[model samples]
Target: MTLSENGDLWCDIRTLHPAGNHPALFLDRDGTLIELVDYLSDPAAVVLIGSVLEDIWQANKDGHAVVIVTNQSGIGRGYYRWADFHAVQARLYDLLAAEDLVIDATYACPHPPPDAGGPAHSLYRKPAPGMLTRAADDLNLDLSRSRILGDSVSDLAAGKAAGLPVGILVSDGYGARDAEAARVLADDGFEVIRR
Candidate 1:
């Protein structure tokens, strides 16, 4: 899939959805799929962790089209360039392709805090619903039936604002207990995946 200048990702819609009734799987990059780093510019920093493809494949098999929604504030922070970020994402796509679990699309927030302005912040960044709205429009997704798998509070907040019913949090073995409990309390349907 390719991200157009307008932020819409192009894909073989037929390959992704034949019946056109599949639910969408929204994933947070960084900590959820791979180990979080300071700002991964080098492709060598890309690491595939713990049956990532297997899990995604299962979701796809169960009639879900997987999409990645990430917040790349590093681009806005001037810590990393957008070209380098694309290079890393390309490498990630190539690696995941080897596992036979190609992602349908990817949506990233490249804006920084200054660009965000106020509490409205980034329209495309997590904790906000901009990217998710774009996803819904581009893919014709049903937000109430969508599932967002994330690794942080911001991700959950984004999903909530987007009206996603389930928010699955992947614990990184840190101070996740309180966060997990809070998630369950906030959304009774939320899940916590502990590794």
Candidate 2:
């Protein structure tokens, strides 16, 4: 794929080779799929907000692979261990399974900001598109046909930088400040704002 002068990454969707022209649905885990909490490590704290299950199920029915891309800075901040995060994720998977919503895969970044002295502003974090790029490579996803639903502008920015066809923002879970920033992005057509 050739890069545009604006530095937007481009790809040929027909070459990706998914059957029947299906698209992959990329979702942000914490806020888009479940209610955001303060570094939730407990398995019981996982809760599906609103119609997430139905939405995912619909995507599946529409012939899309449902994947989760997330950033878990709590691990780098020492607020929760990776093992605890996995336990919580396992419970979350079980809960989603009970609702008949199957997530194809989950990708995450555990690093924090460079100022925090964690991982030095790693590329895997949101707004960098590292995780999304890795997911596309591993899954052979067609970025031009895929969609990203996130709760912050950073998430939308990541989607944009990665060349996703659609970016959706969930208004809840994010704080007031981020929501306002998302509004600006939505107004600019950088993403579709959904509440």
Candidate 3:
């Protein structure tokens, strides 16, 4: 993982293969690509969900940039440090490399909600488009043709706010308990994938 001068943590897949102005697959980290663990701070706990690797591989093959946008409020809540997050991310990168899957970039928001007292809710957090917009600019991604995939409503909402065309909700992680809400999002044009 490389930290760009702009402060984005990225894998820089362009070095391995060139892709220009492609649509992106914006993904939520926890509960989307990996099993959800509350305040997960251990690198050893990184576990990829069965379908995510294949799906990400397919997206890569199809020339789509895969970028992870996650909300890590645990940091703001003092449950974990930034170093812990980096350790977990490094482990995740190693695991994905073993599968021949590469993520183009990762953006995270560490701010907590107003009620949590970390700070005012950040625009970079889910349900907001700041992170996606920054990724699009930095990566030269086409937002209109992009899609977001994850296990929570906020992920879909972020995609929508970013002006992306589609959002897919996978029925795993937090999504399992949000079936009804998922259906509601589907009615609003989001895709709900039962896994």
Candidate 4:
């Protein structure tokens, strides 16, 4: 795990070989991976979203890179520290390991969403595409064929903006609430994988 300058970005990379053209399965950490817990700062609260694991496992079997991209605003909002986030992440990895899952990399934007006048790019926050694009470059991903699965419109929108061809919205977390809005993006471009 490495921290970007200013310590607002967390990059944990474990890719053994750089395929350079592999399609990635980009998963959102909060609702899409573990069950959503608002401002989740406790490792004990970490629970895997059981259904998504099958897809991730299959992606692994298919030789696709598995990466997690998340917006951890709780760190920026003063609800938690980076250390807390790391503890939770460690627990998440342990749980995934128990299921025979391997994550190639994780890109977390620890900053909160930008204010109306603030530039989103500065923080690499979701809905901005910075994190996705950066991860693609770092992991040698094929964004044109990559798919991002998440529970928020921001997650899907970021995938679309980063040139991903498919966006998957899990029905858990905020998915049920943002369904209509997320579907609206499907009409614009990219396939929306509904769960």
| Per-model root-mean-square deviation over C-alphas | 3.6, 7.2, 3.0, 1.7
Q: Better model by lDDT, 1 or 4? A: 4
Rank the models by TM-score, top first.
4, 3, 2, 1
Local accuracy of candidate 4 as per-residue lDDT tens digits, 1-195: 888878767998987545667888999999899999999999999999999999899999999999999988887778898889889989999999999999988889877766733345664788878888888788778889889999999999999989998999999999999999999999546988788
Predicted candidate 3 versus true structure: per-residue lDDT over 36-125, tens digit per residue: 999999999999987777779988899888999998888878899878998998899899999999887888877676688755646677
TM-score of each: 0.81, 0.82, 0.86, 0.94
**How do these models rank on lDDT, best leading?**
4, 3, 2, 1
Which lDDT values do the candidates have, in the order given?
Answer: 0.70, 0.71, 0.79, 0.88
Superposed model 3: Cα runs more than 4 Å off: 1-20, 186-195
Q: Write the per-residue lDDT of candidate 2 for residues 123-167, one digit (tens) a residue.
A: 777888886787677667778788888878788778878887577
Which wins on lDDT, candidate 2 or candidate 4?
4
Model 1 misplaced regions, further than 4 Å: 1-16, 114-120, 173-185, 188-195
- Assess candidate 3 and give its TM-score to the true structure: 0.86
Decide which is better by lDDT, 1 or 3: 3
TM-score: the better of candidates 1 and 4: 4
- Candidate 4 clashing pairs? none
Which prediction has more favorable TM-score, 2 or 4? 4
Off by over 4 Å in 4: 116-123
What lDDT does model 1 reach?
0.70
